[model samples]
Structures are given as C-alpha cells and as structure tokens.
Target chain A: MDSSPLVLTLASIILASTPLIIAVCGEILTERSGIVNLSLDGTMLMSAMTGFVVAFETDNVWLGFLGAMGVGAFFAFIVAFGSIRLRQSQFAIGFVLTLLGDDLSAFLGQNYTRIPGPVVQHYAIPILKDIPIIGPIFFNQNVIVYFAYILVFVTWFWLFRTQPGLRLRSAGDRPEAGFARGVGINFQRYLYTIIGGGLVGVAGASYSLNIKIGWAEGLTRGFGWIALAIVIFGGWSPIRGMFGALLFGATKALATYLQRTFPEVSVVAFNAIPWVLMILVLLLVGSDFTERVITVAPKSLRRPLQRFLKISPPQALGSTFVED
Target chain B: MNANRWIRWVWPAVPIAGALVVTSLLLFFFGAAPLEAFQAMYDGAFGDQAKTLSVLAFWVPLLLAGTGLLVTFKAGLWNIGIEGQIVMGAIAASWVALRMEAPSAVLITVEILAAMLAGALWAALSAVLKTRGNVHEIFSGLALNSIAIIFTNYLISGPWQPPEGGTFRGTAPFQPGALLPLYENSRFSPLSLLLAAIAFTLVVIALRGTFWGLKLKAIGQNLRSAFLLGVSSEREMILAMMLCGALAGLGGAVRTLSWFDSLRQSISGGIGFMALLVVMLANYRMFLVPPIALFFSAVLSGSITLQLRTQLHSSLGGILTELMVLFVLLFGDWKKLGVFRKKDDDG
Candidate 1:
C-alpha cells in the first residue's frame, strides 16, 4: 500500500535483472552469429566463482569482472573452436563444458566459499537521483546497473542501426549469402561467440560483485538457463532480451514478495515460480501451439499476437557451415 | 588389411594414454605427486572388499542412467532432464517407502513401479512438450530440472521432515522394511548389483539385436526416412524417452530403497550428467556402457581417498573423466583432424 515499498521493489527488480540483461544480450549477439552456446549456466557459475575469487584476492571488483569475462570468453572460444575447427557438435561440447565448468568451479573454488569479497560500490547520480519515481528506480544504483542500462541501448542500436550489425545478422540468417557478398562466415561466428561469451562472463561477475554479492556452491543455480530462455522469449533482440530479463526479475521479486504473505507455502516451492512461469511461457510461445492459437484468435488480435510471440531464431543457428 | 586392423586397436589407446599424461599434469598442478595421487586412486578403488563394493554401489545408478541415456542418444533425443527424472523417481519411491503400510514384498514392488512411472511421466511431459507443444526438450528439461530440485528440497525440508525437525539433511532414515537389505552389512546389497547388471545386459541385448532397438536408431538417424519406412516416430520417441526415464527412475528407486538409509538433498548427485558422459565416451555402444560406467564409478570412489589423503578435491575425479572425453574427441579423431589420413571413407 505504501509508495516507498513499491519504489524499493521496482528498484530491486532493476538491480536484480542487471546480470540477466547482460547475459541475454551476450547470448543474443552470439546466437545472431549463428552459434548457440548452451554453456551459459556453467559458464556463469565458473566465472562467478572466478570473479569473486579474483576480486577477493585483488581487493578490486573491476579486476573480478575482468577475470570472469576472460574465463567466460575462454569457455566460449572452446565451443567455437570445437564447432568450427574440430567439426564437433556445438551442443555436445557446450554441454560437456557446462558440466565441467560447474564441477571445476566447485573444485577450484573450495577455498573461496563463504569468504567476503570486494563489492560493487553503489553510486547514486547526483541530480537524477532526486527525480521522484524514475530517479529512485533507476538512477540510484551501482555503476554495474548503470552500465547495464547503457548496454541495452548501445547493443540495440549497434545490432539494428550499424552496417556491421546488418552484416552480423546476415551472417546468421544466410551465411551463404553473406559469403557470396565476401563475408567470412565462420570467422564472424567465432568473433561474436567469443565476444558474447565475454559479456556472459561480465554478467557472471556482476552477480558476485553487485547482485548476489558472494560465491557459494551452485552459485547462480541454473539461472543461466533462464537467461537462455529469455533470449528466445526476447526474439533474440538485445533490447527485448533486457525486457525478458526484467520480466524474470519481476517474477522472482513477486515470488519473494508473496512468500512474505503466504508463509505456509514452502519457500523452495515458491522459489520455483520463475522456472514454472518460463516453462509455461515456452509452451505458449511454441511454434505449433502459437499457430493453433492464432487460428482461434479473432482477426484483429491475431496479427498483433503473432507479431508479439512468433520467434524465429537465426537461420543457421546450430548447423555447421560447410562450403559446397 | 593388417595396417587397418592395427590402427583400429591402437587409435583408441593413444588418446587414453594422452589423457593420462594430461591428467598427470593436472595432478601436478593440484600439488600432489602425479604418481602418488594416481596410486592412491587405484588403491582406493581396489583397496579392499569394502571399497570395491562401494565402487559397485556407485556403478549401479550410473549404469542405470547410462543404459537409459543410451536409448535416447540412439533415438537422436537429448533427455537432459534425466537429472530431473532421477530426482522424480526418488521422490515417487520415497513417497511410497515412507507412506505405504503393506507387506515388505508388496512395498518393494510398488516402490520400484512408482519410481519408474514417476520418471517416465516426467520425461513424457518433456517429450509431449517437444512433440506437441513445440518446446525444445533441452529448454523444458532444463527448467524441469530446477523445478524438480526445488520441489524435492521442499519435501525434504518442509512437509516430509522427520519428527526430529525440518532440515535440509533430508528425511530421517527409512524403515528397515522399506530399504533394500544389505548383504553381510556391506554398504550396498548384492541384489541391487544383480539388478543393475541384469538391466545392463538386457539393454545391450535389446539395443544391439532387437528390431525395436534398430527402429529407435533408425528414427534417431533420419526421422523422415524412418517414418517413410513405417516407423511410428512420435510414439516411438515417447516410448524411447519413457524407457530411458524408467531406467533412470529405477536408479533413483534403488538408491532410495536399498543404496542409502535416506535420500539426501543431492540424491541424484550429478549422476545424470555423468551417465551422459559415459554413453558419449562409449560412442553410443551399449556394450561399452558397463565398463565405462564402472571406470567412472571407480574414478569417483577412488577420488574420495585422493581428497582425504592428497588434499585434492574429490571433483578431480570428475575433471579427469571430462578430460579423457575431451582427449578422445581430439585424439580419437586425429585422423579426422588430418593429423594422418587413410585416404578412404571407411574410417
């Protein structure tokens, strides 16, 4: 009933979603290059652990972020390397790496568990922080949150407005066509995959440094899969992925909020709300189901509804490009 | 012909040897003498009857999971939700084991069936989502795994907490009648081992020799062609997933009913993913699944001593297995990498 509680909740939602927004944006970029890196969960866990450990050691959160990005990019590079050079299944290698990375983080991070690390310092923008609801919601946050906000606009503009962005989209959609126009298809895939992976690392770092604020076993706890799902839900657009991330954050917040009132509901079961919602979202957005729904939908609603939910991934998303 | 035969035998061996060298390097990084850590691992696995039985006990769930994964891999379906399936099976079996008031034999039968049905139903949900709902199995599986884990955690820490109190340690030890009886007070029962061994043999026989197995493989390889050749692709896929789910379910049921006193929060304990590694390492060869599962279980059992004795994390065992698979991917297919070529399509 109170405005302050609503404002604080709104602010927390934005704060919590910063990492997911970064992760989904990274995945959008990677998938746009026609490579699907399914190692997000493991990558995030490993990088989060590494990031926290580095920050704890160095007494600098930025260094932690850098270390995480490097770790993430390295894992992503291997996927691209295996898929492009070794001619292995991207899904297989990525899957194995996810498991390996997760286990490895647990192994290597034994010493770092529960130890306090340097945290991302909050910075409230001077003039903007005073601007009523908007200022309290967005302006009064850490540098990472600000960076995430900026990243949304920057990536969206870069993807939709820039010439290279068009070429990147082209590479994913029809690499053969891109190749005909003199684009090096595989090279682009490798480049974007690594870049996206590094971004994913930063997202992981944000969890330890800014959001969750520490490392633990199973840190992130399969939340990376949520980011992956958000990418599809976002229709693979960086801006839309940010919205999806926010939506997921809102769901988590709602679960936490409702848990306060409904104490009888088991906390663990309530915590599963986001996942259940995601599965439902995927079911509803599914191609065949949507087509059926569109048929039943009134004529006026069908177009807008289809436009809202129809998600067509990059054409060469998983296929290994072999020159004929 | 002689050279070709030689390459077939030697090629696989080369990568394993390469993996040994790489793993030794990793051990050195872990600050344990490579030879010392490996020796400890060997001693731990075959140290005594107790240790060896422990390894076999570990192998039971692994082989159960691997056999089910075998079918899915052959069917060209990735049942990544085996982890959740395993958990679901345990949940169902636990539900019966704790609540049922029946004769021991009847209880055991119902427990096993419940676990299998629970696992099958969970997997079928994913399959239904895949076939009818247009959701990819991977996504649905991933989501379900989290949901299942949270649900299990709730049951353990919420409603089903032992009379003592609610805690994450899992439910208090099940009644003796609900558990699989131990043989001579060993960590596991002989009957459990026999069951896994029998299941493994049957799965191998069915996958290699049966027409049903061939059809699953056919559907996996080319669904359109298989359908054209009079295969029921959709129904068969669901059945394949269910069979795999049932196997994983049995893994859970065995672990609950016999293997352990009670379910831990990490009841599945990453065995689902490990089984995937095993099946992949075996190159989808059902017969190879047992040895590979055994090898992994040995590595896991052995690594416990590595942790206690050498101060290395037990996860080194998992890391070592992963490295071997990576090496196999690299060096097993060195010829494909054009390190050397036979100039023939046979390889």
Candidate 2:
C-alpha cells in the first residue's frame, strides 16, 4: 500500500508524457501532410482553459475534452483556410495565431484562475496491472494516458501501412505528383491540419484535466514550442515523435526529481536542460550534418547511428501548392 | 499621381482604424463600453504632460528594437531572438552596474557597450547556428529565448538574489550612479531618449546611403546571384544579425540604465516582440518607427489603466497589437511587408 519512489516516478512519467505524446503525434500527422501548425502552444493553452472551464461547469470531463478539440479544430481550420485558400503564408498566420490565441486565452480565462475542476480519474486494466513494473507504468493510468498509448501505434500503423496514409505523405512530400494522381492536395492538407489540431486539443484537455490539473495563465507556456521541436527532432515520423515525446517527458520528470533532491541548485537551471538539449540536438542533427557524419563514420556503426539521428522536414511544408 | 502618392502615406492608417473598430467590438463583448474604453485609453496615453513623457520613455526601447528589427528585415531575416538578446543585454549591463566601478558618464557608456555586445553575441550565436549548423532562425531563436529567460531567472532569483532573502521581485537596486538621469521628478530620462534617437538615426542613414545596405538589399533579393557578385553572403548575414542584436541590446540597456534600478525576469517586457510588430507596421521605414512605437507604447500605457479601472485584463494590449498586425496583414499591401517586391508585380 506504500508509494514507492521508482513506481511513483515511472507512473508520473507516463502521465506527464501523455499530453506531449498526443501533441507530438498530432503535429507529426499535420506536418506529414505538409502543413506547419505553429499554434500548438496557444491552442493548448486556450483549449486547456476552455476544457477546464467547461468541465468545471458541466460536471463531465469528456465534454471538456470534446470542447477543447472543437476549439483546436477551429484554430486549425483558420490556419488551413488562410494558407490553402487565401494564399497567405502559413508560417506567418500560425505565428500570429500563437500570439492571438495566448491573448484570447488570458482575456477569457480571467474568471477561471486557480479554480479546481474535475480531473480524469485513474483506471487500471485489471489483468495488465498485475504484471511487472512495465504493466504498472503502462496500464495503471487514466483513460487519456491509455489513449495516448494507443495513439502512437495507431498513428504509426495508419501513416506507414495504410492507403490514405500514403496519400497524406504524398500531399506533403510532393503535392504536384499527388495532385496528378487524383489526390485533392489542398483538401487533404485542410483535413489533416484540422485532424492534427483536434488531437492537439485533446493534448490540451489532457493537461488541464489529468496531468497538470488546473487553468492558469501560461499553463502550457513552453510546452508547445517543445512539441514543435520534437516533431522536427522526430523527423516527421509518428513513432519517432512519440518516442521523442516520452524522452522529453522523462527528462522533465528527471528535472523535477533533481530540483527536489538538489535544493542548492537553482530550479531554473534544471528547467533549462531540455531547451538547451533540444537546441544542441537540433543543430547537430540537421540532415546535411548527419549526412556528412554518416559518410565519415566507421562502416558498422554508421547505419544504425544514422537511423537514430535522422530528421527531415516535410519538403513542401509552409509553401502553397501551385500548378505548373 | 499626386493623389496616388498621398494615398500611399495614408494606407497604414486604415489598419489602425480597422483595428480600433475590431477592438471596440471585443470590448463591448466583454461588458466595457467602447466609448468609455477609448476615452479612458486616450486619456491614459496623453492626458497630461507627465503621461506624454512616460509614453516617450516607454517608446525608447520599442524604437530601438524596431529599428533593429528593420535592419534584420532589410536582410530578409526574422530576428525573433531579439527578446533573448534584450534579456542578455540587461544581464550584461547589470553585470557591469554591480561589479565594476567608474565615473557616472564613463560607467553608463561601458554598461551600454557591454549590453550591446552581450546582446550581439547572443544573437550571433543564432546566426552561426543558421549559417554553419543549418538550423532555421525561428527554431533557434525560440529555443534561445527560453534558455535566456531561464538564465535571467537564475541570475535574478538565485545567485544574484537580493540579500534580503529571495523573491521574484528582482535583484538588489543598482547604485545611484547606475540609474539613468531622470527629468525633474518625471520618470522620463532625456539622455536615454537622445541615445535611442541617435542610434535609430544612424541606422536609418546607413539603410538609405551605405554600400553595405545596398549589398544587403542585393543579397536579400537573390542570395546566389548576390554571392556570385562577390557579396559575402555569410559575412553579410552575420553582420546584419549582429547589428540588429546590438540595437535590441541598446533597448535593453536603456531599460536597465534609465527606468528600472534592478533587473527582473520580465525585464524585456516583450518590447522586442512589440517592436517586431512596429517594424512591420512601419513598412521598414525608419522614419515611421518612432510614431508606431509611440502608438504601441500608448496602447500598453492605456491597457494598464484599463486594468486598474475595470475588470479587464492587461492582455488587451497584446490583443490590440495582434489585431493591428492581423488587420495590416489582411488589407495592407503585401509589398509593404517587405517580403514581396513591387518590381515583381510590374515584371
């Protein structure tokens, strides 16, 4: 009946990583179809606050998540419409939305500050929870966490092994070619971006309802940019992004643990670890740098190492498609 | 032709008017009367001589940062990391204010230079990453910003914490000599104003008349051809970034040496970003930077009063800034944004 540190930390990591996992997976799917939704941070904040407010008022957590998704999708639709139909810069619009969304959330969320609301209840799968440490870490969590676990596999399977997934990848990679092959490139982009936004909304709802547990200004302050970075670090792959999300979650958990144990060390220093590491990784893992490194590497180690650090942005991302 | 020329000067105002209308709707929705909010906003911005000077004081950093942003925009770079550069500049100035001793004039000079150098160096790191490491400026800038904030937080709340135990208030107040000269009990410092105005004037001159400015234009137009023409692309890129960084640093220094006695985590106060919007609104014209900066500073000053007098949030300033940017993006000529060339339309 006693809480063990190891078990608790592991459980916390899973819970901590869930929101990020959902966010990264969402971003991966969106970027795979060649759209950059730079509004993850704002979307998450707005949705988290909305989710919390709605859940607090409705006495239902699922409604809050749904409301958050709707908010997320609405923002994504705006970005998609701007980029696809209006022929404006997606990057510019998304950047603007990040500021706009943050302000809107702060303005609207004035009444909801520090208000306690319903949180997602923990539910353990009976047979699975009885297993070793892995079971406890994986199965003994909320439904949102379980959904995040399922999302990684489902996203990977859909992106790599299905027909629509091929269309999606082609829409991002080479839109002209996909268009010639009868794919509605812009429509596909719109659909995927909104879908991605919806998942990002779920991530936001998960944060307020399950992980961090409240509405606050700057609740997900730095997390959105981290998710955006992870998408790049993961090289636009669902599985890699999922792993990157988990790695980031573990790093955060480790930082929190370190902050507690090493009281003398400034907490900000611990907080800076992930950002510094992300930048260093981003610089070192550029496609060109990786190419040169792999070319000069010893034969046996090169392939696996190359595979490990591989990251390539979607070729047609952030540019509007035009017929030649 | 004269009418057309006249309209060109008036076009930027349309967005401001449109944004005001949009903001009115938002205010009304939030239960504040549009007229009352506008009257309150105007009164807060320029109701008295004291208010006018305060607006001028706040405009200095935005002006400096906007001019810096104009430099980067000229080179077709987005120096979003200016926020970090601003913070780094403050840290450097504080380092001098606390650790070094000199005459008042000499001390302020060294502090300003150190701040600019620190900001330039921080920005230069992002430039190097982009030029040598193949990382985009946006990502590098975004990441660096978080890192710089953490670094500033560490200094302010940890090692550089005031001796009176720790709080998020900021470091111990700087010595009297470190603070900028204030004007007859007004918060405004005429010296800081002169410094900012002089820096912006030099930048405007350089942009209009210098060979380096022409080369930046050429490079921004077409990187490969400009490089083929012997315009050192990497060198120009780094120099442009550093100049902007230094400019943003100057903004930071003014804030440090003039307004506030101690450095805090919110020292930059998003002035770098606000300046970014100003730069875009100014259409890269250095002459327009001050007015735009003043308008923004007014919005900010007014928003503070709005918060005090009503249940409204201070984030209304951010909303208004976003509104202005959005309106401009939607209706203003895209060519004015500097990303599109008018010549291309002709061709």
Candidate 3:
C-alpha cells in the first residue's frame, strides 16, 4: 500500500528483469541440453516485433505470444537441424540466425514502430501482495512476472527432480552414454531446444507487451548476450541465474538513480556495468585462478568457496551430435 | 577433379540466387517491388561519382577488417573482439590527434601506429583470457566490446569534450595535419586505401608463403596434434589475434581519420561486424575477401538511397547479406546439393 521510491524502484527492477529471468531460464535449459542457442539476441528482437505486431493487429495479446513462440521455435529448429542433423557448427548457425533475426525485425517492424498497442493489465494478488517488502517487490506484478517467479522454481524442479530432467542432463553432459542407453539423443535435443526457445519467445513478448511496451529497432539488443552471460554466472542453475538477472536489474536501477541524482554526471558509461560485471562474474566463476585461490584458502573456507565458485558448463555444449 | 573445378564456380551462385529469392519474397510480402528496391540500391551505390567514391571509402575499412579476420579464422579463432579493437584503434588515434602536435606525415604515421598498438592490445586481452583464464573468446569479446564503447563514452563526455560544450556527438575535429589527406570532397583518402591494399597483400603473403601460416593452420586443425608437433598453439593464437587486431585497428584509423573528421560515438558503426559477415560470406577465402567486402560496402552504402526511394528500412542491406551467408553455409557443400553427385557421402 506504500508508494515510496524504494518500493517503486524495487518493483520496477523486478518488472524489468522478468524478461531476462525468463530468457536466462530458457537458455539454461537449452545449454543444459548441450545446445547453445546463441541466437537469443535476435530471437528476442524478432519475437518482440512479432508479438507487438500480432497483438496490435488481432487485438488479442495471447495470440501475439503464440506467434512469438512459433517464431522462436522455428529459429531453434533451424539450430537443432543444422547442428544435430547437418553437423554444422552451432555457433556459426546461431550467429547467422542472430543477424537474420535482427535485420528481419527491423525491416518487418518498420511500419509498426512506436505505435501504441494492447498492454498486459496489472493485477496484484490480494493476500500475497499485502505482505511487507518482499510482497511488494515479488507478488505485486502482472501475470508474466508471476509466471517468471514460478518458472525459475519449476525449471529447477524440472532439471533436478524429474526423470525426464535427468535424461535431459545426460543428453547434454554425455550424449554417447545416453544414446547407448537408448535415450533418443537427437530427438531430446530438438524437443528441449524448441521448448526452451518458446520460453525465450515468451520473454520477448513480455518485453513488448508488458515491460518496455513498444517495438523498435533492436528492442532488446545486448540483453540476450547478458542473459547468456548470466546463465554461465548462474552455473546453468535456474535459481542462480535468477539471482544474476536480479543483480543486473539492480545495477541498471542504480545507474538510473545516479543519473537522476547527479544531473551533471554522464551516466551513459554506466550502461556498460552489466557487461563489465559479466566479464568479472565469468572470470570469477570460469577462471583457473579462482580455483587455485580456493585451494589455498583455509580448509573450512574451501568447501563453501568451491561450492560458490564451481561454474563449469555442460561438457558437450557446442559440439555436433552424431548417431552411430 | 574436373567436376570439382566447375562446381566451385557454380557453387557460389547457388547461395547468391537463394539470397535474392528470399529477399524478393520478403519484399513482396511487404508490398514492395523487389526489382525496384534492388535497382534503387544499385543506383545508390554507383549512381554517380560521389556515391561510388563513398562505396569505395566504406570498402577500405571493411576490406581491412576482413583481411585481419582471415588470419584469425585461419587460426580457428573467432575474433569477435574485433569490433572493440576497431573502436580502441579510433580512440588511440583520437588521443594522438587531439594532444600531439607534429608534421602532417609524421602525425598521420604516429596516429596510425598508435591505433594499431591500441587495437592489438585490446585484442590481446581477449586472447589472454581464452588462453590463460579459459574464458571463451565469444563472451570475453562481447564484454570487451561493451567496455570499449563505454570507455569511448567516458572520454567524449568527460575528458574529451569539445571546446564549445559537451554534446556527446564527438570530440572536436582534428587538426588538418592529424587527418588523412582526402580526395576532393569525398571521404575516400588514397593513402588509407593504399594502406588497406598493402595490408591485404601482406596478409596474403603471410598466410600463403610463411611458416607461421602453416603453424596457424596446424593449430587450427588440431590443437593437441599441433602441440605434439612442437608448435606453440597458445603463442600462435595470440600472435594471430594481435595481427588481426593490428589490421582492424588500421581500419579504425581509416574510419576516424578519413571517413569522418573526428572520433564519433559508435565510430565504427557496425563496420567491424559487417566485416565479420563479409569474411564468413567469403568462406574465409583470402582471395574472395576483397570483392565480397566491396559488394557488402556497396550494398550498405546503397541502402541509404534504398530507405529514401522505397520507404523501407535500411536494414534490407543487412537482411540480404545475412541471408546470403546463411544460405551459403547451409547449402554450400557439394554433396548436400547433389546436383553433380548421386549418392550422399556420409563423412
């Protein structure tokens, strides 16, 4: 029931990060399946444009989401087919798709730029939103934000708790063994990649339809790469990735606050914080130096340090899959 | 063997045709005439002396960047940090032009050298991260790219603001001596183009005739095998990246000194990225780089007029090029086409 700047900023941070949370979750799933969908930046742009345009024309928001998801799934299918069936480099295919998606969005969305469109109505959960700081920040948001909250936990449960999740992990971590066990490796890759891409599409729709509220050239440029970085920073765990998104959101909020507070300062440089943080976080997690430092630490500190710092990727993240 | 000779020439056309078809369908979907758009683009690129000169000016930097990428690609490294290298090159040249006072020729030479050094050092950071820290070049390169852009923002807004005020547009124009000698009113500078041409020749020589080139190929093919054969893979990779960065930096120097009078925000303006696409479309063939880069430059340069004549987004240029590269990569394999062969040979 409060309108304090602190509460509002916190709420806004959560709202802004919803798209990233969904995207990181999707990319985490894809990479967990040993497929790196590097087309996230372009996929997000294309879907945002498609979501906005479809929603604008049909006057139905859900259809927009569906259309966006279809676009996402199609792009992912290409990646899966190229890497899995044709044995082409996933990075090469993904990079091209990213460019194609960007250019396509700009060209197609030309007629639709800056146009007002249907928006997702705000809804607050009566009971949960009544709580203190946490409720205002988490529960007092739109349906997509609510979905993002559930999605992270659901992703964690799906990856760790379910049998199918175990098979998915095996597909990415050890495809040969999985195939030997008759896991239908390529099929799982295609299925998960598409599903993950659909979620990414939902993230894009959330941006145009909910958070940012308009389509433009490069509607969500650079954030997709940030999500990719956060996935690594999260160690490919949905929960950790959620935290990474939140941290990025907080930095952005802080940058905006600083710019407003100190009118003379050029905080445009602050836009680079997420990227700089990306490198620093990856270095902390991915570098051998950190491992050595953890080794030299006190024995009691070593366990927690290793637990905190362990961020290895799936063993077969970018390689082609072959059926013998 | 005889079939292969003709196949190589024919193979290149398939992707080109596929690209045209896809772009045409896209234009038709949007209710635009595809042929009209293409004609507009062609005219824009070569409509007159100035337009063609502009295309050539754009081609110089693109050619330089693509030439550098050839070295990195040969070493099996994706030097995506090249965008940052180019930016860093511009900043270094700007720093020299802004602060140093010297003879015209000496200042130009020093500015270029500084730009090359700065670019190489920036690229070396990515190389070091890959080799020493085990961070992938893609991620590091992306991060470095952002950092370089941010650094430019800081310089422009804070320290390097023009004498009049802080517009965030760019620093003040350099002294006449600091700039490359332009050809009439055009952005094209014969010196810069000559430099690009020389860089291309040197790279071709290095890749074709030198032992270092063979070592790079070995490292690219199989890192473990190369190491087993007494080649230092890490050092070679670093050297390759630095060499690529140096050439890319030269491109940046050309961009700032000749293309524009001063260092502007987004100085390279996706030229570095376009070069990456150019090299990819060229299939990493050194010989294909120049013509392909020139084509890309013309397409992009012509897209300016495309936007005016068609009321379409200028990204049509990007769309066409990306589609071409994608189709080429997807269908380039002769066995996949099955045009000249009957059975699919499983690799």
The top-ranked prediction according to TM-score is 3
Local accuracy of candidate 3 as per-residue lDDT tens digits, B106-138: 999999999999999999999988888777788
B1-347 in candidate 1: lDDT tens per residue?
Answer: 68767887788988788878877887787688999998999989989988998888888899999999998888999999999999999999999988888887788888888999999999998888888877788888888887888888989998789889987989988878888767666667777778778877787787889998999999999999999999998898899899989989999988777667777687898889899989878878778889999999999899998888998877788888887776676556765665555556433
Count steric clashes of candidate 1.
Answer: 1
* lDDT (tens digit, per residue) of candidate 1 on A93-182: 788788888878888888888777899999999999888899999898899999998988988998899988887887789999988887
User: In model 2 chain A, which range of ten residues has the least summed lDDT?
Assistant: A1-10
Interface RMSD (Å) of model 3? 2.0
Model 2 lDDT, residue B76, Cα: 76
In angstroms, the error of model 2 at B143 is: 2.6
A122-225 per-residue lDDT for model 2 (tens digits) = 99898888777777778888899889889988999989999999899899999999999988888889999999999999999899999889898878877888
| Candidate 1 ranges with C-alpha deviation above 4 Å | A1-3, A296-302, B1-9, B341-347
Alpha carbon lDDT at A228, candidate 3: 87
> How far out, in Å, is residue B50 in model 1?
0.2
Better of 1 and 2 by DockQ: 1
Candidate 3 global Cα RMSD: 2.2
lDDT of 2 by residue, B1-347 (tens): 68567767887788778988988888898899988887787788898888888888899888888888888888878788999999889889999998888888888889999999999998999888888887778788887888888898888888889999788888999888877888877768898889888888888888889999988888777888999999998898889889989988888888877768888878897888788778776657778889889988998888877877766888988888887876676557634443334555633
TM-score of chain B of each: 0.95, 0.92, 0.96
Over 4 Å off in model 2, which ranges?
A1-3, A260-264, A287-289, A298-303, B1-18, B218-225, B283-286, B333-347
iRMS values in order, in angstroms? 3.2, 3.9, 2.0
Model 1, DockQ value?
Answer: 0.51
